[model samples]
Target: MICPRCAASLTGKQRSGRICAHCGKRFALDPAVHGKGMHDIRIRGIAERATDHGRLKITLTQLWYLSRTRNYAWAEQDPQGVPAGIRWLVALPVAVALLLCAVLTDGVLAFVAGAAGCVVLVVASAMRHRPGRPPRSQIIPSEETFRQLMTGAWSTAYGRLPKGVVDDARPVPRPRGASRSRASAPLSRPTAVILCTDRVAALFLTANDIPGRLGAVLLEAAGTEGTAGRSDIVTGALKELAEYRSALPVVVLHDADPLGVLLAPLIRAAQPDRVVVDAGLPVSAARGKQGVVRLARHNRFADAEQLRTVAGLPEADAKWLADGFWSPIAAVPPRLLESIVVRAVERALAAPPPGPRHAHTNGFLTWPQAPQTPHARDTGRPGAGTSKREGTSSA
Candidate 1:
């Protein structure tokens, strides 16, 4: 194992103390790292190493003063200067000089000069103590650099590149109580197919009973199966859609990041005629929401491709994505995600057949019911509401 604190290679003996001989720093091995998986540990280690040297240090005097002070708002307010009394003493003479000049000169010209002097003083005072740029270590790692380090560290620790979670080529298990007879079995097409960005999101949704409630099939778009060039599950899903000729909606549930937003578009390319809705975490939902995990800087082949594919997105969104801001679908409150999925499924199920003009409008589509016609609104027969006397007179 490599010492996370020093980045030095460690032998089996050194692993026992979890200490780095080079840096003389001791690290407590987090049980979660080994318990969960090595991938997470690697990511954390990379982030730590990237920032450890870059962290800014404060002197003891500064720390003591900051702790003792009540009025000082470090980083928020400017540092206190010469006492207010001293400032006033200096400003009084300047003010008196300005007043004398104003009285001696044209009032308008004097006023303008006085205003300019005040502006300069304020600007100089404000600029004098402005904070400098934070250390690079304090700044979050860039997506590219973070990914490189994560990948390199993983390779060094595991002797191989990390793989996607859903890379297995095996077929998905059939639902329980499916028909036994192959020929006579009824075709079971889901109302909507839910595509996840990764395996964790898929597993989370599965654990939360999303499939049972929504009757949707969950798929990982960048799963190992897709990356390995043997996407049996995806192929099977596309085949099923073709075979059933079902107008089933495809819902993409992904992270609230650049790559996730593009999942719907990728799925749409496969089924151009089908409706594809982004049920994934949206930017709005991600904001102020807690438990949002960041995407690992390093990406597998599919992930890199996804980033490339979304290049044509609007400048702001593209920049945000490129900067590596992401929140996984699991970060969303499970109940909220479940509710969103339920509503999406219900809407899809209730949607009317597409019209000629709406055939291509299924991309980024919503499920809104068409307005009811006046004839359809009538509850009884055409003449049923008429009075009996009126009916008899008409007869």
Candidate 2:
């Protein structure tokens, strides 16, 4: 372990009771008790990278993913310690002695003992041949473990999280149409709406003020429990679309899961005239990569057939997601996720007004295509000379 305050390497002796011997300071986490990869220094480093060395702000949920050392699978073996050779060495003397006694004394009892010893040796060999546990790197620690480290251990030690790490940006939920935080301040008629399938991703963007920078309103995609209420933080989406900006471009960001892939189409159905850009994480990003951290769900919320037919996801990806595995967009480093959002927002901003071709359905990140015909302005598409709208949303 390394002392977070003094940057001094520590051994078990120096880290006794979770205190630094050289600096005489109390620290948050001990790798000895937690996993071998977890500690105060490591946490800080991961936070720094996620923030791009303090250029960006990150949420606790994002940090949780960055802290993982392994990507767990559904079926993993338990480690079987102690080799069969070692077990055989320990029992060989006893077994040979018993067999020798049986031959010398011609005793039935001694022969029975020798048979039992042979059976034990056979069982030990069989145990050795049994499948061994996977390596520790493949075993993912639960989110609860990281939560305790941040909430309990890190808080107790540092009095707060590391710099640039925002745990709960909005601790208390605000009623709809209320502006309580700086992140939720009203904008002047937002021309675009950024719908994040996961509330955590939306919260991250809000906490970091990413939407405000991009001149967009952040909304939690409907269908999840209690998420409808979150849309109230600003004005209702219907009012924003129908009254304020009827042709507002909607940018959808989501995890690489069944529900995520289906969310963009749902949003399009809700507002057919609006331009929709699918900025969600693709299944390919999380499915086959050994290094990607994919979390599993116990229940199957959506099916592969729907993903393939409706969302247009390929067969293999749909099958993987139907098995209830997902990788969160929030898991992408804060800087990268923010940058991608910026790019998607730019695409949204370039989108034209509603017309016959009002939406986009490209693969991973679909952008509204350029107006195909002349006099597109007559059909409601934006003209080349049209100026970009400066928009914002209320809290």
Candidate 3:
């Protein structure tokens, strides 16, 4: 391998560290290229775990899709995480009702008997399904937070060079009049980059434009794809965070409000003594709606903004708080938001700071899509209720 910076021949041993010795350029590596299979398995396992429990989140739009096309078994199951007891209970009443129907109908009038049994079965099942658990709210960290984490330094930051090094503003040709040799070959800018966004759609949009990088996590999506809290997975993701080898930077970009504010703290909580920067500043303290306003009222609230003097939005957009579009979204917490923030914050420090405007629209916000129907989870699905097993189990 050759150092992307100084064009020096990089021995395998020297390549072990994620920097070029000749030019002191740091880099981020692709987790996908490093070991696609292993990561796939981990992701699949997490997805399965989410499916088994009611914790898995599927948007109503997706549920409608699955209902129309996928297997019936899948439709009944919750992707994030579902309770085991409910599975058995749902099966129990159907069996009992059929047995009672058979005994009372003298085992004749099979069709009519079956219909009656099903009616009873449906009613009992409805009764069993009554209010399992309160729904958990989906939380999304805001955008523009990448700067927030990097406002100061902590541990080292890593990232991959943007693709298209061939025609890049900085070309990769042998030094003028230099002899041709492996030592003279320039390093390739990595194919893709990583970033963190609380909203999956917004992350996709960012990743979509980056030549080749794909957003690894979708915080608002269904199943374990977005959920956090698996130590092994989190550790692996963190390990990936710690080890990339591109001269370019990885970043954790999130909103400037409450959720984004939490990104730095969350990363520090994961790895202490590490300094992270706050990428974008909140437009002002008065612009503090969502968690900002909510937290401001709290006893620990600091950095109160003087709305009177704050200028227009940070870079390009309007005021961060007054904009009903982004403010409400700043409140919700999405599952994948944390990891996305971590990735974006790391990237922002290495790359140019992002412009002020965010990419998401009103439709992208979670609360608006919340279950208008009774008992819908804020994540946009049915709420979980207490298990019959937890209540008075009737044998």
Best by TM-score: 2
Per-model TM-score on C-alpha atoms: 0.39, 0.67, 0.24
- Candidate 1 local lDDT, 1-395, one digit each (tens): 66766677776565554455778765544223331122234434322332233231111111111111011000112243465555666766776676667667886888876776576456445542222221111112223433343345444554433222111223323333333442122225455677666555465454334565466666555533223433444554465456534477766666665556655665556766676666666554343322233332212223334454542344544443444344456534333455667776665566555556654453333322222211112122221111111000000
> Which rank order by TM-score, best down to worst?
2, 1, 3
Candidates 2 and 3: which is better by TM-score? 2
- lDDT order of candidates, best first? 2, 1, 3
Global lDDT of model 2: 0.65
lDDT of 1 at 395: 3
lDDT of each: 0.44, 0.65, 0.31
How do the residues 1-395 of candidate 3 rate in per-residue lDDT, one tens digit apiece?
55545667766556455565667775333122232111212322332332233332322221111111111000112233324476556756776776667666753565566776667556554543232222121211111221121121101322311111111112233323333332222223332233343343243222222212232222221113222422233345345545444333333344444334444344444543333333322434324322221211111111224222222234322322222212222222322333344444344444432223311110111112211211112222223433111110000
In TM-score terms, candidate 3 sits at 0.24
Count of clashing pairs, candidate 2: 5
Model 3 weakest lDDT span, ten residues long: 66-75
> Can you list the residue pairs that collide in candidate 1?
147-297, 147-298, 166-224, 167-224, 167-225
Best by lDDT: 2
Which model is ahead, 1 or 2, in terms of lDDT?
2
